[model samples]
Target: MDDDRTRGAGERIADARKARSLSQRQLAENSHVSLSLLRKVEQGSRDATPALVAAVARALTIDVTALTGQPYDLGGRHLDPLHQHIPKLRRALTYWDLPPDGITPRPSAELVRGAEHAADLRRSGNHAQLAALLPALLTETTAAIHTAPAGREREHAYATLTVLLFAAHSVTYKTGYIDLSTLIEERTHWAALASSDPVLGALAAWARTTSLLQAGSYNIGLQLLDRAQADIPTGREPGESVLRMSGALHLRAAMLAARSGDSDLAHDHLGSARRLSTQLGDVDHDGGRYQLAFGPANTGVHVVAAAVELGDGDEAINQASQVRITSDLPKIRACHHYIDLARAYLWTGAKEESLRCLTTAREIAPQQTRHHPTTREVVRMLIRLHHRSNTQLTRMAGWIGHDA
Candidate 1:
């Protein structure tokens, strides 16, 4: 293995600190992280958690991706081929206001079906296929919106485009295209508002909170979610769509609260999500119409994720054991659950079990697994723990461009 090139977030953090002329103690104090923990991370003896990375990034006044090394292009055979489609997707998103000349979109019903198929690809974790489909779909949908009549036809076109844009955003964000993802989010909000659907608008707001969470702006993130919930009428006898979107907001809020160290507030948000899930009952599809899954199973997934964010590995494991993850659940969500489990087990000193969970995640969704930062962190930790060579683990590490 090329040890010199095997730099991780910790190495990057250490270098950033040194370049800024800040000592380890000073960096830890400014970031509000424990000095010992920061030292271990810098020495490559520990994994850098998202919370720790975010806190450190804020103190350094750098984007989290700067430390995490996002848009990680190893230019190797193991990286997902989906990166090739990013430029096309960017152009498609850029030309939302200008439909390409001489390109006629399909009929309304056909476009709707295409959009639904795109959503299905996203839910099933077929991101490569979804990425390939986005540029054309974006162009065609934009054309439909441009040429459709001013009344119901235009609204329907905009609605279809909104869902497609959301799916596009999902692919871009997961592949580490943060800037493109932000642009897609902006386009989605515009499309959602133009669609005249309150629920879609709320969905946009829910998605927007992701940026706030990454920036460690927990309080402002909570306020945005609160405003989104208020926009949706949640009085007695609210419809299922409203409940689904509201429940999703709650799940996101739980994540933000947990990362901010407010365990009590995080649990409160999870409780509200549970109540909403009960009211919604079992849904036929993972995401259904809203493109955001919010049922008992999904809520359980959030609980595990929030526990991990709060650094409560035991709670995460306990919650995960009871969460019935069925086949119909979105592959991305199920894959994420396993990723969380891997971390939980690692934190609890079950190194082999943690490796097993990561293997399961790779089996469920190879593309998403390969691109995820946490996957890389866990693999690095596993390598550090097992000084002896293990072929399977080393190969897994190599898949994510980490030579261990």
Candidate 2:
């Protein structure tokens, strides 16, 4: 697994292609990717885009993680504390239907506050801190829900647990624990439905799209978002939470549309999200209170992301330049923006600028940067283009499991 960290997706793809007895041309045609680009990626001269990775994974009949080499072995780094919590989390999630015995939950109000704090940790990209918090939080929240009276208190407990599960999902999925993250998603949906809160349900739908995107089920993902939006009622004014979730769904839909090659639909969703964000007026996602962050900044980030997915690097760079990442936005979201910007820059042949973005992303959230697949991809790209060894590039490559 440690060596797996040094290998890029192209190497894995080549191995899989050989295992399947298929040539590069056959893979290109099967995956609907350009032969030249496929050759470059396999030859270690090109970075694998998310859209391309997903397509190739589908064509190879393999998991996207199989190519991306996720849950990367970090070899006892400072971030090892995060992985220590996974077993505990898996146990907690496994006991979702049955709260662990001999545990007395705190009052509902205190539990809600704990859930909020977990959400804050997640939004801030404090993966280790968030992981440290969730095992206890999950136990307490589950116990709290079970012991509460069958009424508002119980419903509130379920909602709080749902938000906590979202935080749990963030740590698990981002750390490459895909199976655990999928379980967390299922628990989240169960809790959300139990809460009977349409807003929470919509948030679950939004969370589920990440898996859909990874699997390249774009149309189904779009349909899920549409259904989520429709389920949230708006007979009266669509309040801030409802509107923000709607905007979040549109942002997700835009990504799905872009990956699906529906450029017009992608832009259309981006436009809708922007309008909703304008209506929300500087939604800083205050501690992720609504369990979904949507604002001008996030909308802008999605615009750049959609452009990148559509293979329009120029558009991605242009949109990213116009958008200001305000102070109140979450570090996780901001870090993701820089990662996408780095990719966009790489596509435009702005190698130095791309490395700058990667460094900025590392500064914003070191743990996230260390584990992100795109960060590794961009680092490899920069390494490939460098005629001479760059100290920073070499160090970054080593940290990200690449041989610089």
Candidate 3:
């Protein structure tokens, strides 16, 4: 029985590697395991210990149970990408901010490799691991940028730094760790170096505006976005299927203004984005960040959220109901959609419908507290409303460990 089980595990691992289009040697190299070990494991000549199983799992970007065909529940695991690592990053930033001589410069090759590894982790959706490594990665990237020799190397370093900042922002909004102001300042400094490269300027501007908007500085975000849009040179038609940078900037600005209580401004900005999106056809030419500006369910969902914030629950619910959730999309967005619908129902005094929506949201995104900011906010509102009416929101509160 033991032999059969061991062979089955080995076969599964081999199949998974093949399915991922990775050679044994490639898997070995990526996993930091010896080729001999990998071969032995795949051939069923060796039994994988827990450490080896873990190493293989990490290499495959999966949990150990997945390789073993055993069911493992991640129910108790906190799903928030930023929760565990953000604190570590805060500590690392403190350490890095110390006296100049207190820090030791790491090898340039190692720094570059680390940044690449973080990028790979981000792409793999292992955002928790990416967040944990981000502080060290940022420190190394910063050091590399400062010490890099003039020309292409420096440009590469700057590009890497920008990528890291954007990744960090994706995991958390308005976390004090990433200095939005300083990033804008650095962009200005680097802009002088790449004055001839309009694309690089646009990328920097995109990052700056995104960070500012995420930090809730809507006015500053709008100003930066406006400047970026206006500076887009005329008669420079970017090759096919790309929305102009101006349109992209306006789209983001619209979302920011909507979230910041400026409904009129939001509508104006979104109108420009929609018109430009129609003209552009499919993709953003400048950065290719978003393919379709308002095609995704997320676009309508954000509009719903903005409407809800503006006390238009009827409009919010109507819009929220129109969004279609797909398996391919991030689970977080679906979670937001249901929660928004619940809130909309609650505001319109439809308690039973609201509860039903909340239940659905909780099931789809079980670890809602860790994943969605709006989840907790909606729960709190529901609890308060029930409390005022001398009714109990026990089930809703229970989803997030709150007693109502």
Candidate 4:
């Protein structure tokens, strides 16, 4: 064992706990480790077992990688050679053709359930589990699409595949395979087109728009968003599903517009989101939030995010304060909200508050908070504030595979 490395790990744990405002006794109680063990680890007197490390990481509201100072890998191998799918997926995304590709009428419950469960895992920030599940899901969804009878049943199959492809995009994006994620996004849009539900097809646009925004193709993304929304009818007021779907698109446009420095356009889109969310009883239905999680709470969070992007940090924080009903949001969305607040706090030089928000976000969705680019930027700022010390800030830098 490397004694020096072990001690450094201990220092990180101690620093992370202090950063979160937890005492040794509190962290011990929270992590369910004995106080003596926690103290020893903190004081560099002992090393933690893998299980102990994981528990402590969770208690500290950080990714296990943070404590371990390693990249996220499944079983330390990261990914099995057999588990590699992104390369194949890149080619398949160009023309998604499932063998025996006919949509089955009345797809088996097991088949439907599998797709839903995979989406659930993706949404819940279970990247490791999702990575294990996605390849199998792709195969099953392909099979389900192939077996379905023509017409509505086949449409359902396409819809299922769309969901699975979107899930693929999500997990892949989180894993840092940005190009592969974009391919999956393309595949999702293709699947959505084959599905009869135009609204669903519009919802699929969310995936591509996100990729475009991340890639800095801001105008193209916003243009596509506009085109997709243009296809949806506004006659006699749209239904809840349409409102949710279109409102979700508009919010994406809002964020993109804000990033591009179009404050009026951003606010216009935001106003649309607020109106739609208000009409839908203030929340997008949790079960079917178009996979985008757009609602009043989420919209407020986005407003803050856009404000942060626009350099209105104080205004962003103020908007964030108005988002009080966070308890009902999806964990991922709640995590995003905190990260946005953290960025805003940092922008305003409110370092302690920013750190608090980051810690809170980690508590909500540690993996997402740890891996997200915005969160990473905030941590970089924190490292600077800590004078690039080998203490707490350096420890956090380790979590994200960075050096202070």
Candidate 5:
């Protein structure tokens, strides 16, 4: 690699190691490098020869080209052609000095291309590939934040960090490392970095709250959401929407309480959510993108889910059927809607309908069906409903046996 590129790569490696909570000594031990050498290299005080770089790369279990963007065809040529654009991404971030107004002038061509590729990877269920690319992305994005010349630039960095965290969440969720407490902590740190930007701060808070809710920490999630709502600016433009944030926290809280057999708390949260929706006036579908908040359709879906959990199957089926998932919005919310519908149907003894919905949900977003707790619970219930005597059901039985 060229001298500048080599230095950049070294810094990125150092940042990645740090982000993983590894010390230079620890990284040295893991990478089979001397402690002194690792420190020297990280500080940019010593040149990392190609051989040493390769050794470090192997130790980190990442491709050497991932570090330096060199065209290396090692025995494993798994680095996609898309990896070549990373250097340009790095340069664009540096050139812009990390402005906060959402990627000044809408990011460079190369950066936009990289974002598109990353989004595509996310959509294609190539989570492992995306995870492999994340360290470099995180390092570059963090560096841009630190070197950002202005508040706007810093905001940009925070936004990038938000995206990176979501990507990490996706990968970890897929791999079943579902204890997102650590991710929540990291998100909190990033939120602090963007505290001056209310919108970004709210977004960060929503991300953290969503992770907590997913992990079944309903009470804590509700607390975080309350704090975030308190921080939201008053009399903001109608377009500056926090409706989804308010709605999701209450909706998820209601879901959690219901699933855990707390009917009163579930009702309370669901009621609060419904009231908030009414207070927000006509629905703002566009604003829902940020928080995936329960709209009219989703509010009813949550009610159905809670009702099912509370042993009111008739109410669940009725409420769930009233929801129309074929809205103009994205399909993710629809996926959740269908998954909940499946659960309601199963509880109402409509086994065939439940199976059909589950199949459709899997087709729409297999990851959602596989990773989400509510969806997995619905699948397990279906398995039990069919009276399947298999290892998969046996394992799932043990998993949800306590709840049942």
Candidate 6:
């Protein structure tokens, strides 16, 4: 029997179309799905492809999650702290005052070490450790910023604050705390501006652009990147840090462009990133100096991810095969690479290969994969294809909290 969740997807499509006063034929024409097919999908007699679901949602001007519903949402009981912290983080953004009551500005040395440690946890994919550290980091950085009477020390404190908030925004956006993510992004920009450095400010904007990409706001993200790119400082032998920062921004622009279907533009930005990656010192083959990890290996991972996003699965697989995941690579990045490769295999009808990739991802970074939105969708797609024939697939579906 067809489950209500599956049938309910059709119900949402139908309801949304009707709420907009569109007929079946109208929706079919608008979404570019066949009228007969749209009718079947609406009546729940047939399942829709992810692409079809996306197209229909686009036609209706709603989020794809709105159609999938919460049952398919990733992040479970373990993410409860993230859920609680989102509101608290939002309140921090709203107040915009430095140092919550009874807090003293921490020494710059303490703040720097704390940030470096937190970033280490992030690269290792130790999210629980990072989570434990973030709230205090956010508080201490805020206190440090206004503690000094307007000078370079205060500016440096604000820059550190920007980095902390950007890191928070990345986690919140991925874990589905979208509203809080937006606020955190705004705060990053504010801190960057107060830091009185163009590069730092643009990096903050880059973080916000990444959040926009998470929300599928590709056009807006690309626009933001273009604006941010203009701020790339021009002068005297731009050193390693400057190169890494510039490269990170271009790399993200490549991804947004790829998703938007501008292949030439995407490749152009990708080339810019590749050039910068070479200049990023020997340590970066693992991932660069910056938290964003702009390096050769990471750029290659983005190339594969970009291919997957552009629906070029064969290209994605071909590129993925060449990309090596070394131990030094950030587990967060390496995990996403496996997920991207798995999705590519699925696109090419290599179901078992896709399953293997998923298994590897779970082995490498269980929590991140289990909580990721893309991971859920990939598992759902696999279930749709192999659930009846593969016992392992069924078990995997259950593990990911899906009932196929």
Please report the candidate that would top TM-score against the real structure: 2
Taking all chains together, each candidate's TM-score versus the true structure is 0.96, 0.96, 0.58, 0.74, 0.58, 0.84
**lDDT scores in order:** 0.87, 0.86, 0.56, 0.70, 0.56, 0.72
> Order the candidates by TM-score, highest first — what do you get?
2, 1, 6, 4, 5, 3
Q: What's the ranking of the predictions by lDDT, best on top?
A: 1, 2, 6, 4, 3, 5
lDDT string, candidate 6, 122-199, tens digits: 666665556667887888788777677798988888877776776677666556566667788788888889988777
lDDT of 5 by residue, 215-311 (tens): 3355676677677667766565544365566666677778667755689999998898888767765453534224344456567667877886566
Q: What is the lDDT of residue 241 in candidate 2?
A: 76
Question: What's model 5's lDDT at 322?
Answer: 72
lDDT digits (tens) for residues 1-404 of candidate 4: 22322224567788799899988999999977789977865664444443355567768767644665432332332232323655555544544584533433344566667778876777677766777676655765676676678898878778887877887888777655665776777788788899876776787787887666654467898989999898876679677777778878888899888876789999999999998888888654554625667677878887887796666789998988787645556777788778878878876888778878988888887777766656655675566565535455565656545455
The true-versus-predicted C-alpha distance at residue 85 of model 2, in Å, is 1.3
What does candidate 1's lDDT look like per residue over 1-404, in tens digits? 44433678999999999999999999999999999999999998888998899899999999888888887764654456788888888877777777778889999899999999999999877888999998998898899999998988898899999899889888877877888788887888999889888888888887787777777888998998999889887678888778888888899999999999999999999999999888777652455668988888889989999999999899999999889987767899999999989999989989988999999999998888877888988898899899688988988887778877
In model 6, pairs of residues that clash are none
Superposed by TM-score, candidate 1 places the C-alpha of residue 11 at a distance from the truth, in angstroms, of 0.6
Judged by lDDT against the true structure, how good is candidate 4? Answer: 0.70
Model 5 superposed RMSD (Cα): 16.2
In candidate 4, position 99 carries an lDDT of 59
Tens-place lDDT per residue, model 2, 292-371, is 77888888888998888888889999999888898877889899999999999998999889999999999999889888
Off by over 4 Å in 3: 1-84, 91-127, 172-217, 232-235, 239-246, 259-261, 279-298, 326-339, 352-373, 385-401
- Cα lDDT for residue 389, candidate 4: 50
lDDT of 3: 0.56
As for TM-score, the candidate ahead, 3 or 4, is 4
RMSD values for the candidates in order, in angstroms, are 1.7, 1.7, 20.5, 13.1, 16.2, 3.9
